[model samples]
Target: MKKILSVTGALLLSASSYAADLTIYTYDSFVSEWGPGPKLEKAFEAQCQCDMVFIAVDDGVSILNRLRIEKTKTKADVILGIDDALIEVARGEELVQPHGVTVTGLKQELNWSDADFIPFDYGYFSFIYDSQKITTPPTSLKALIESDAPVIYQDPRTSTPGQGLMLWVKRVYGDQSDTAWEQLAKHTVTVTKGWWEAYSMFLKGDADYVLSYNTSPAYHVVTENKTQYKAAEFSEGHVAQIEVAAITQASKNTPLAKAFLTFLISPEAQTIIATNNWMLPVVDGLTLPAVFAELITPKRIGFTPKEVAEQRQFWVREWRSAATR
Candidate 1:
């Protein structure tokens, strides 16, 4: 009887080990303790009855590159944290499978028809500054370029916010993007590899301003009860960044992955993502805290995926040349 009991325990252990484990590749910030990752993990695990593992990379662009390197052998069942700026590149690589979920109740401002990726949360790219430090914040990109205020930004090669700023400049200046970059380069104290590094530097008083999202101020307002930080709205209009998640083509657990994707836009998940990630929730009816409601929502500048795909390389090259000069 003792031998039988031991064998039974071993069999149970083996069965548990063989159970499906869904792996998701996401940005490092999303998985941090204060981010929505922990809460989402707990909520999903309770419903799915399966193991959920999150593998974090540097940023959204890095997530795509890593998936490309692994190709079909990628262990990522789902890729999260990709914004609209990089979605064209991801679709070009054909790294994702169609989500096939009938999405609805998205905010009227966002119109998403893509069947492959589901919108999770979104925010408008803006420059953030401490009101006390910057008594007169630049109201336009031209004003910012002309000012002597020190600024720090991320590199577009590795960061989504960096790419958004690049596109923002291009959208504002058009053929004179090079000129804009040259002026911006003058005030730029330094350019880091990702958003967190640049924002950290700004918070540490390394620079007068940092490139970040309009919703970023909400985090400080709600979490720390500090209201000095504010997003500067430029006359050129802010770039809208719609973040998305999708199941990878290489996923072994497609059903579970699909279920997770569906859950992402659900009211429960959106509430956690909006409050913790400090972004606007895609779905409606989720009650936002007072701080979020007080955040600025700027007029958006629209760009198509085709236009972004066609011009991204040229814009980056132009930006690099101007910045270096």
Candidate 2:
């Protein structure tokens, strides 16, 4: 009897070890301890009864490049943390398939009609400042450019928020974007590779302001109980970023990948994403924490994915030339 029981236990352990893995590719910040990845993973695994694996890349753009490089050999069942800015690129590469889930009543600032990618969370890009440090924050892009206030931002080539800022400036200035960058370059203290490093520098008083989300102050208010941090409202209106997720066309686990996408929009997973990811939930009828209620809702401005894809390179080049000069 003892020998039989030992053999049965071994088989059980082997089966457990061989459970299917649902691999998700996302940005590095999404998987961090402070981000929504772990909690969402745990909740998803409970229902999936499979191993939930996350592969972190540097940013949304990197996620797209990596998927293209891997092609049909990709291990990614689903790709998360991609913002609306790159949706056209993903579609152009044919990296993702239609989710086939009928979504309705999304309460996001932007109307999402893409059948391939599903919106998970969204926010408006804005400059965050410490009230004690800068009493009068710039109310417009032109004002920020002309001000002597020290500012730190991320690079568009490497960061989503950085790309958003570039887009924001372009949208606000139009043909004069180069002129805007030339003036703004005077106040730029340093350009980091990613959002975390830049935001960290801002928190450490490395600069007077940092490019971040309008909802950023909610995290400090809810988690740290610090009310001094605030996102500045701009007259030019802020750029909206709608973060999304989709199943890769090459996913072997089609049903499982679809199931994970379904779970992503569920209330339980959304709540974790909203509070932890520091962004607004996409679904309707979900109550946010009181701290989130205190956040400033900016006038949102954005471009279609196709428009962004076409103009991004040109804007980046113009920005680079002006900033370097």
Candidate 3:
């Protein structure tokens, strides 16, 4: 009986070791020509001698919904690129497990909580304004809402940055956010389903400013090689968000998945994220792309998940009604 038990344990360990083909579900950019998907696939295969398959979906919500639909029969071993705002959905679904591996040199600010998730990089949401259209950008959220200048924003219920904007208002106005939303309602020219739509409209000269990240201009300045747009400085600071990765509970190769999470924090991956992914790396000492290293200034804000969570649904509902009118 003891020999049978020993054989059973060994077989279990062997099965786990053999199940190293990793499937990661993430957004489109992670697999795009400029993103880290190709590099990660190459590096992980080189290091682990296992297959790394990335299933690219439209956005974070679709990825989470796919996991929920799959449930116990989940297809991916890891889930990456979920920002702080959507981290709750991943957590609530019980999709993530506590990663035992430690990531080296993650920024102290990123240690926001000791949750199951690990933050890989972060950025702040601020209006990306066309400098040619508006010589003087609005310096505060109140001014943006009140300005006669045509403004475009993504719908808070559907868009990540739009959700960030809602959180920004809740953080600044607190209990009076309902009134603030009412004020913003009057100025909005259109509410898009996603950032791509809103930003495209702004770029085509339809609006003066489009709600987006401080780091967004980094992409234009560095990649596109022109500074046609810039992030507006707000007196109330900006809504900062951290993107995180996690080992999925559905992973058959838990150990390998954990190792990949560690790899994502490596200098190699963080550098790719900063230069190609258009996000600030979580690693403290890594230098950013030359243009970003010069153009972007980090904002100090009191934004927190707790405050944002409390008011997110309320803000989304209010915006929906106001937007329709």
State which candidate has the highest lDDT: 1
Q: What is the lDDT of residue 108 in candidate 2?
A: 44
What is candidate 3's TM-score against the reference?
0.85
Q: Over the stretch 1-325, how does candidate 3's per-residue lDDT look in tens digits?
A: 2332343334334434554688898877678887778877886576666788899765555566678789779888888866787766667678888877544456777665544777777888878887876787878888887667778887665566777777777778877777777777677788776666787788888887888778888888888888877988888777787877887888888777776776677766677778777878887667776766655565667545654556556667865665565
- State, as a TM-score between 0 and 1, how close model 1 is to the true structure: 0.93
Give each model's whole-structure lDDT. 0.85, 0.84, 0.73
Give the local distance difference test score of model 2. Answer: 0.84
Q: Which is the leading candidate under TM-score?
A: 1
lDDT of 1 by residue, 140-224 (tens): 9778877788999888878889889998888888898888888888889999887888888899999998999999999998999
Tens digits of lDDT, candidate 2, 77-169: 899977899888888889899987666557744567888998889999999999977788888877887888899998887788989999998
Give all TM-scores, in the order shown. 0.93, 0.91, 0.85
**Candidate 3 — which pairs collide?**
none
lDDT of 1: 0.85
lDDT score at residue 288, model 1, on the 0-100 scale: 91
Candidate 2 accuracy as TM-score:
0.91
Off by over 4 Å in 2: 1-19
